[model samples]
Target: MQYSDKYLAFMGRAPKKIPHWEHWSNPDAETYLTGIDYYEHPRLCRLKLSQLYPQLELPIPEKDDPKPRPKLDLKGQSSNVDEHGGHHVRWGDTETTQWDWGKHFKDAEDVFAFSPLAQGDFTDIPVVESRDYSDEEKLYQEYRKMYPKEWGDKAPKGSTASVSFYNTMFMWPLLTFGWELFLETCLDPRFERIMTEFAEINRRVFRVFSRLPVNFVICHDDIVTSRGPTCSPKWMHKYIFPCYEEFWSIVKAAGKEVIFMSDGNMDAYVNDIMACGARGIISEPYTDYKKIARRYKDCFLAGEGDNRILYRSNPDEIRAMVESMVETSRITGGYMMCIGNHIPWNIPPKAVKYYLDISAELAHR
Candidate 1:
């Protein structure tokens, strides 16, 4: 099946089969893959593949150096792909070394500054809205190169857009201030100011999403923990949704579909996201898939198989997990089976194969 065919199904358009996608393992996952990769460096070919396809081993030249994997360091900075299609790393938080003296308010900028963003004042951002659009431009170009069918060239497969940018509301605060500081900031009198300025900052930076040629964008916000919303839902409505509301407004005007992704048990916020006009919802295991599929069948639903199962499950347990996800996901025509959150290297290869095998068998069933 052509890659685009499944994408067509995802968009509720006509297609050949169910849609599927996979991302490269993170740099750190290498620790678990050392045995398979053999060498210090691993190639893209060593990344996960569909069990449906025959394995064609590519010879690795001794001198060729594989591209480096991304990193998320302390202070909440990450060279993660969700930000810029892997072009740049995100920088937030600043004070990893401060003693007890740093907790109290020093000034407005301190409130804004961080383990990264604390020193940043809202007004300090230039009104000119300075940023390079080259990353988005590069993505557009890459899409044309890889999926020329979308651009109306002679087509190998017919599918819709899949790539997207990762943006968040509450996570940024968590990244900017440490968890404790961020939670406390929600109670500070200046909380609204900080949120507004950050939202404005996002407004300027995210203009690229609207201008891109594609009609789809992915957004991410890890707003909830395993238990429930980390902060009051009211705070999220007041401080967070406004920013997403504005961001979604731009995409809406551009005539695009947004697939929203998050980690945690955020069932309460599903309606909130739907209100933002998210046409698709990608979630971790914490969110109830069966419940959501029963409610939002019109919207595309992807990602539900928990990574923890892969990290620590026997073959029987893995089978049960896939069986349950398939049962729930198949209810909605838009479901795409994927490992929710992540698949760390520590996941047993046999278990990974088991997951993939089931996905291959039941993807379109």
Candidate 2:
């Protein structure tokens, strides 16, 4: 099988052109690009856009009819209703977010009393949102089912058949205890036991990942915010980074490369993450891409492009952004063109056009 340029880029092979790895959700951009009404013909619109820009890897919908949207009570709300009786101003695919640690436990004391190993099964837990996560073998089988039947138990060489986990390490406690509770108790000596229990859980997780039929594993944990680290470096080294080293080591032993994904500024921890055996990082726009590219020398970095630039709708700025990305690509074989913050549903279509067209014209090694 012919490996895609994206797969090559993921492996740090430096394909002739810089690959596009985007977080896209701009329905208006699709309509503008394809000349199709997205709400009326969602599938055909995506199909045409995919044909137009295959590098974007837009998913081809299996159905022509748009999925049913929720009829929210928009009384006294600013959102306009569409002909389909749905909210017209969509910010993203859905209002629902993953890792919603709803009001399960009452307080920090309840969190401290919890034991991940004793629970063993996490389906009952509000934080373990992923299915089949309680059992390592079952989780492996579940991921195995996602790959093509032709590949059997192993992905083809150079294929991008990979798995991603949202709560890599830091998120385990954060999701389990809820944000405020986690912060309140993280520094206490008792928190070490909680972190230890969380680490044990991830040991099973990474071992399962090692057994999967994939070449890469994308591990996501928002260890930092757009500003900087949420937990200090000293605290992180004690609790978080060690688990990453141990868990990632499990997959690395099986010849699988780890791709560390995070949101916000990862500038401080990039080296630490790399030291933990990640092939590269895909983070938000707050990171220093050129500095990473120059230092790491093409270890698969992305999320340098900013959506704010696109939102501004300035042609020169968009072109300059694309050109700067291309310059970074010249420095590193593993650079991908990505708006780390994302191309949300509200961004102007014309700005999206300029970014893509300019990238096509100039984003080459």
Candidate 3:
């Protein structure tokens, strides 16, 4: 829960300018508590490498012990299946990714037969016809049963990942069907009905979600792509936005900080996302960070530490990128640094270190 308050405070009530760089430099700074990564890249695992570099405020692994716990069948019947019978496998044995949809659309009809969603041809929902069953219907049923980290009496006494709550409530619906299907459905004329069923499925999950003691909840729904939206903006307004509203309303009602995270050129949705009640907007580099940080002063703006610059930039360019990003984050107040997308394996390890060094320097300033 470290810096959770500062993160919440800034988002809950961010001021126009963070005049004092001193507070940010505070070793106890709330910003230090924030760590976000989704990658197979070795550089992302700071804790594992931290002992070699003690000076950096690198990410600490949640586990105090390296000894493995009893391996639960995280992937179930089909090698770690979730409630929807989706296979959940890690990518290249890294701590970062869980390969699912990008691998195959879980629970999709056999006709899909493991083909990518783009391959299918459907006039209606690309997924099987929608279904809304009783509350007894579990979404991440196997996931919960297999690995219940810090749940109930088992809650840890201290530091864990920056995200205290591991939740996929919003994303579960998206994954239950999948991105391709969801996008196709949203574009289809029957968008409302299809999305409604999706919403109903989420309702059942959230009903269970309400019981959890989590203050920070991340709603991962990457509805955008490099070009723009995978779904049309108009479709987003009518069908998708309502789903978001319904999904986030529960978090808002529970007095939680909604960290709505998205991946691509999602600048268009910043205001709408904030309007939908997200206290924090976790985004990637393609998003307009400067505009969001400057304009949405009251919201926590995260992840503008573009790795693309690090991947290709010379030392000077990397420094400038870090300085500008750090400065903007400082001016905006509630900002958490993150690399663009994943820290791809090709990225120079030195570059990552340099980025962190600059961030640490900025943090200490």
Candidate 4:
């Protein structure tokens, strides 16, 4: 099968074999070629290829030099005196520093500053309300001009394009508002209204993109905790699912596949995800693949290798995990093998190579 054919099969076009590729371990441009070569290798001629091009660039932060620890004063006060002589009240309810909420916005004009939108800082700003519709349309047009294949590329021969919106809803609320306040807002009627409004705006942005010829719409929203979801199933059902249903339905209606990426164990929400009309869920290997495959046969599954094991496990252990994942979940189709999450930066490069080489060998079987 060609790469497109294998990808389509994974997306439920036909009963076919899963594609095999090297794991992304090296933080270098070579990873892309390695993936392409893995699919093109003679042993895996039966599978198809799907090339993913990640275009986002981030500034690397400067590292700090290690230093000795400073001694503590231990008296809940500073030993070194300043111009104020460190004589200020040490303990008093009235002496506490007051928070100025006004500092959040620099000024009244800052309300419409909209500088972050130009820089791609979609956080905190209302994407729908803040955006100039004409400018957004121009941006979309430019993207389409640059990568016509992403939208115009047809199946059976060419690769499809997928773009991801940062996991704004989940990230913003937790980072901007305190966690306690965010949770409280979920229960509050007024806050729920705000969430709904934001969700609608997000849905509109997606709708505009869906009108283009893209093959897939991917959204990243981390919904799970170490144990389960941060919000209860009932709460998600009440506040979150409806927005997803609307969004997923719009994508499906537009004839584009929808995939969601989340982290952590998500064994409990597989049904809820299917109900939202998402074609697949990507996450770490913590999710119970066998259970999810048995329940939602049509829904695609991605990422099953345990991320932590990549840093510590030997080649044999990695091979075993890959073999078991393929044997158990790829039987009925709709499975893609990937690291449970992005390969860690500190992992030895050799271990990463071993994981990919082993995965290729297993998939050939």
Query: Tens-digit lDDT track for model 3 on 1-365?
Result: 34332443335343332211110111111112224132222243445445543433445545443332112213322135558765554322222224334234443343233322232222233222222224333433422453356465222333121232222333433554555664444444544544555455556545444444445556777767765676566766776677667767875576555677777877888877878777767667788888887777656776676667877847788888777766766656666556656554335556666666666666422
Candidate 3 regions with alpha-carbon error over 4 angstroms: 1-48, 52-185
Better of 1 and 4 by lDDT: 1
Residue-wise lDDT of candidate 4 within 1-365, one digit each (tens)?
Answer: 45553465448553344553223423322233334232124222112212222211122223323222212213444234438444333211112232222235443233233223243434344432233333556556654564656436332233456656654355434433445555645565555545654565566567666666666777777788657889888877876777778877876787778887778888888787778888877777788877777777656777777757777858777778888777755544667667776564345556766666666556532
TM-score for each model:
0.69, 0.91, 0.63, 0.67
lDDT of each: 0.58, 0.84, 0.51, 0.56
Residue range with the least summed lDDT across 10 consecutive positions in model 1: 91-100
- Cα TM-score of candidate 2: 0.91
Clashing pairs in 4: 2-48, 3-48, 3-49, 151-213, 284-340
- Identify the candidate with maximal lDDT: 2
Which stretches of candidate 4 lie above 4 Å from their native place? 1-6, 13-17, 20-25, 28-146, 149-158, 168-172, 175-180
Candidate 1 contains a number of clashing pairs equal to 13
What value does the lDDT take at residue 146 in candidate 3? 38
Task: Give the alpha carbon lDDT tens digit for every residue of 114-181 in model 1.
Answer: 32234333233221222233344553454455444455533223335544544356655555555666
